[model samples]
Target: MPTADPASLFWFLFLFATFVWPAWERQRIHLRRLWKIHELQRRRGTRVITLIHRQEALSLLGIPLARYINIEDSEQVLRAVRLTPGDMPIDLVLHTPGGLVLAAEQIAAALRRHPARVTVFVPHYAMSGGTLLALAADEIVMDEHAVLGPVDPQLGQFPAASILRAVSRKPVAEVDDETLILADVAEKAVRQVQDFVRELVADKLPPDRAETIVRDLTEGQWTHDYPITFEKLRSYGLPVRAGLPREVYELMELFPQPAGRRPSVQYVPVHDVEPRRRRHP
Candidate 1:
């Protein structure tokens, strides 16, 4: 190999320092700026959208994203609470048709005893068991048209009204033993639920006011699906406020109302069945 010339080496060094190195450094700075820009966008975007529900499907293929609360929802609620910062307040956006009374009570109890304040925001409706939990919040905020329904316990698939109606329409001795027993249980369940509702509201309302609200909700004065409007709840003397934050409606739009039934398979292609021939030797 020929020995390197000083002139060639000098030119090479000058070109690297003058052009190549500057381009390389400039590219590196550009990359860093791009990273910061994306990072800033990600940070700001988090405030507008909930990061916990980044994907509609997180895990458990059949479970809902955030549609409603049921007896099965305790684990999800606990997980949400665990993931949240302890110092931050818990804001529950409720829109449910209610579920198991016990589960609703557990959720309500958690809200009542949380270390930080709990606020429930109802976008559309939170009925039956949903109303039970709303009572536990320090502040319940709702959209103008949002509703909270009665907390009358259901007997299996039938409403308590069916059972109560039987008792009201017929004398005790005239009714069958099994029917009488069921009616008694239903009456007791209604009373117990009313008392529980009162207790849940007592934290936010005075004892007398709480009693009135609970009585109205559980006395079967309204149908189970009744839309106890925001204005109606406010008149009941609970600390119910109208006008929810914008974020609540934004989140509501994110979830489509849950469809309980699986969609039926719409189409089936016609095909002929093949028959095998039997040979007798």
Candidate 2:
């Protein structure tokens, strides 16, 4: 290796420090700004907008923190909803894998208490406890492809986890015993969930229909491609209709519409202020 020229090395180091360091720093700053923007869009709302990212579990374990709400924190969300200005509609966005049943009910009850119309928008999937929240909404808006999972309640075992474990444990021979036991366990769990959901929906849906819905959701060993669409929900005995409410429609017109078929989930942050534009010359 050739000996370095001290002057040249100094100049080169200075150039790198002046140019490369600033560029790298700028890139990092830009990235941080972009991340801040995204987080603001996600959580910067004051209007008690609650997103149930994952409803299946309370703690952040294998699941992402975005999913589910802690029951206690969820109550705070409820209090916010209750205390929100009555003049403005409450926007509740849900995208959950479903969570603790009792927690779900508490959230649902808080939603029910909102004097302003409660609009639920599901941009993606809302299953189990998430579905229960949807039921409490005055209006549920879902995209054509968006889905709401069955309200069938499962007991101690998280439905997805339990099913996966059972499938994995199946024996090559004499699997009947294992299958039966799992089925029985699943049935009881599902029934418990359905009963709880039914109680919540009794005031909104007819008693007999609620019972039937619960049975339909829980009785089947497992609902593959569970009923989620409006047509399916109606077929399953839920009261839902297509088209946005007049107020929701008007709100959509005021904001920058989301790209695509239209987001099934629409939430107006409590802190959102109407943008003002100068009058044209």
Candidate 3:
């Protein structure tokens, strides 16, 4: 058997310590930084809960972001809220395209049940399911360009407007039986959304007012994709304010922009075509 060299083993150990120690230390610091941020927000008021759907803008390396809201997400949020004191208020920072209706309701219910106030902040936009969540909050804060979308529910691949329109345009007897059934379901789906919205804001506003706002948002008053900007939302008699908490902007900086969106490297001249390597013969 060959004997191991003490000198070779010593250099190998030195190399490992030199390269690996820095990376390990950096990882610890990164985790600690995130923990400190959570602690800071917890001390200020409620622990801030962030829900960002993978928007094209937030996509990393041109890879789409994961869908924003889902059943599993609500469960995770429930566990997080329960970990904190019941009396503590919550600040939900939302950016979503909306998801399963049941999941949104589950999260909304949890927010309403919290003993303290719930505030939702939208640095960009929150649509559909996201709007459902914001409605559940005691107050909603958004940047001027931030928007919330209409709450009309979509059925499978069908749009609510198209389904209801098709049924209404043709006589009930003339319409296909399946189409009629879809139309009926669409009507019910709309009503459910309106009712849910009103109920979410009921504690904050009078019933009549809440119903009026909910109706406007749910009754096809706007396109499903319409950007209901912050100013317009304030007009709906909702408790909406302009601007987000300071930390939201600071945190936004931590996300990496795709290379195309980032500034050109300083070493590369603006007018120069990027250099490419030649194949060797």
Candidate 4:
């Protein structure tokens, strides 16, 4: 048998440490996340699915890439929903900045048809399409400070409402053909979302109340990036509650945002605290 050169052995080990180790570490974190998800499932007695889209630095230059609800996400979620028994409840941990409306609508429609209860957990914020998905849930579980956002459609880079507003301010002939076309599409988009939202909440709320909810969310009452706080959602009579499972929070930790050169936010991880008593004056 020929003996390997010492230099070749040393370089092999060096390359493995530099490249292979990171891949292995990532796999370990993935497995840990799965374990946490299973633990949450056992505690809640529901099938747990996570639609978490975190920004990650995937390139050598550490350029952060954003993730969102897309066709692939919708496909996977629909598959998971189908695999679950009809009688089994679903707990969806949703953390996204929203994505394609078409994909989101597909997911929401499937969840609406599910026979068992569907709960959406928002550990942070779920905007646009994310909010659309939450609307399908029987109950929305949010962190006290978590937020939802308007579902008004976006036409390219502009809000559909904004497009219509701009066109309405100008005379029909003054508007270019392209602008008129966009305005037409915007009108239809807004109406389509309003009708869909009404359908989603019809079983849960009275007709008048459901219409109100639909208008507030899909009629561009607020900016597309507006944060609908827990309190505001409650004021609207949405079936939203505060409090998230500890396991869910732990799971979020495993899907961390990509680290920059220096940490943007940092704090000591103090688990529990007792308030300090004031001395009598």
- Give the winner by TM-score: 4
What lDDT would each prediction earn against the true structure?
0.69, 0.63, 0.78, 0.92
Compared with the true structure, what per-residue lDDT tens digits does model 2 show for residues 22-60?
A: 568558755664454344334534243646443222221
lDDT of 3 by residue, 1-281 (tens): 99889999999888777667646755875576477458648666777887766444332235545575898999998987788687887888788888888899889888888888888889888898899899888899998888999887889976676688777887778988888888898999988887788788787777788888887777777777888888887776789998776677665544434434656655754659767799899
Clash tally, candidates in order = 0, 9, 1, 0
Candidate structures ordered by lDDT, highest first: 4, 3, 1, 2
- In candidate 4, how many Å is residue 174 off? 1.1
Compute each candidate's TM-score over C-alphas: 0.65, 0.53, 0.76, 0.91
Q: What does the lDDT read for residue 259 in candidate 4?
A: 55
Candidate 4 residue-wise lDDT, 215-249, digit = tens: 88987789999999999889878899999999989
lDDT of 1 by residue, 1-281 (tens): 89999999999998897679756855875566445434433543311112112113322243555544555586667566666565657777677777778777887877777777777777777888788778888888888878889887788876676688868898777889888888888888988897788778766677777778877787777778888887778877778888766555545544433334465654543455456689899
Evaluated at residue 31, the lDDT of candidate 1 is 67
- Which ten residues in a row are the worst by lDDT in model 3? 54-63
Candidate 3 lDDT for residue 200: 85
What 10-residue stretch in candidate 4 is worst by lDDT? 267-276
For each candidate in turn, give its C-alpha RMSD to the true structure in angstroms.
Answer: 19.7, 11.4, 9.6, 3.8
For model 4, name the residue pairs that clash. Answer: none
- Winning model by lDDT: 4
Q: Model 3 lDDT vs. the true structure?
A: 0.78
